[model samples]
Target: MVMAFRKKPTSVIRTKASKPKTPTNWLHLIKPMLMFLCLLFAYVMYSNWSSWLALLDKTPIRAYALTHKTQFTTNSDIRDLLSKEPVLKGYFGQDIQEIKDKFLEIPWIKDVAVRKVYPDRISLTLVEHRPTAIWNQTRFVSAQGVVFDLPKERFNADGLPELYGPDSEAKKVLEAWYKIQKDLESRNLVLKSVAMDIRGSWTITLNNHVELRLGRGDWLPKIDRFVTIFPEIEIPDGKRLSYVDLRYEHGAAVGFISQ
Candidate 1:
């Protein structure tokens, strides 16, 4: 039975095929890490630069120079001003705008330009106010109608025409003065001073020491009449005209100087 028996058919075992192992791309793996390192290095450099700048700011200003546009302001004045603020910050760290504002606070300075130079130096360009007339007793007025005052010793107001008025009316008074002066010149009269009282009353002092009183009415007409009649007015020998009152409607009242 064993010799002639057919062998049972054996089932074949099949194994799955293995996939190929691909090599890793080294460049792709290292690129992101390299980028991160570069970014970190740049940040560190920027931080160091900021720290250097901060340290430089702590260094004090070593030298300062001023350029004056006019002789109205003196070097001593500028030095005195600087002396008050002895410890100006470093040139690179200074607040230029703040320095300009402080310079403008000086009565004689009208405009100021501040600059920081290298190696701890600062330069200032100063434009001073030119006095065109004496405003009241303590102030000065410029041709541009700027009113300012400096120390009494810094300026000489001897020859300047004295102007008096409310602070708010400075520009108006200055404009009126120019017109009045031109009109008065045609009559051979020189205007020495002008004043406006709180009541808005106007008065002018001539070079010959005569005063003209122009009230709050229409002063233009009054001024015209005076200019027309001024040349014809007679003065006695050894006596000058003292004052002319122009507040009237038609004509003005003239008074002679008593001998």
Candidate 2:
């Protein structure tokens, strides 16, 4: 065997070449996926909540609960007026403006404020017209110079001044009356009534039963002139001043009560 046994050839095994693997970061992908799922869940919840709220708004139980919880307080006249209206209609469907219009239809209501409280209530505030004087014995003149009428039994007109004039001349007559009243008040005189006849002639009755006739043109100057000379006029001892006619150009005609 030591003699050269013809060296036997050894066979080498062959293997396939493998490619390099790239590392994958699962944390980044998982973070974005979790964020997307959370967003989707939140959107679904919000949509459901919105739908529930809308349904609640139209529910009859909600409207009934609000109706029972509503509170209203006003004068008897306003209350009576409100009683004629369909005020208890479905609360959610009730028109606030319609309520306000109904309130304004009342003759005495000047302005109305309506408010709706959340989840169940309504509030109303009413401003009533204040009558300053009686107009033509049928209507009333408000402090803002508006003419309106109401039930005679609703208000006391005992001490108010009686202002008579054509319907178109109400404001003018009121202004003149106010001016004359202010002027006469400076002389310790009280005006009981003011009247403007169909001929546009002005007349005033005093608290002392004295009547003053002021013809149409430039009566203010005559009134001023009379105010200036009133204190200087002298009456007979047994007589009292009864009437004054200021229709003259320069002077007034005075009448006296016979004792």
Tell me the tens digit of each residue's lDDT in model 1 across 1-259: 4578789999866555555567999999899999999999999878786455656775766677876455766767666666566346665556677777777878778898888887677788888888888889789888888888877786777988889998777777788788778878877779988888888899988897889999886667877888878888899988889988999887889999777
Worst 10 residues of 1 by lDDT: 12-21
Model 1 reaches what TM-score against the true structure?
0.72
Cα distance off (Å), candidate 2, residue 191: 1.7
Taking all chains together, the TM-score of candidate 2 against the true structure is: 0.59
Q: List pairs with backbone clashes in candidate 2.
A: none
Best by TM-score: 1
Alpha-carbon shift of residue 220 in model 2 (angstroms): 3.2
Error of 1 at 246 (Å): 0.8
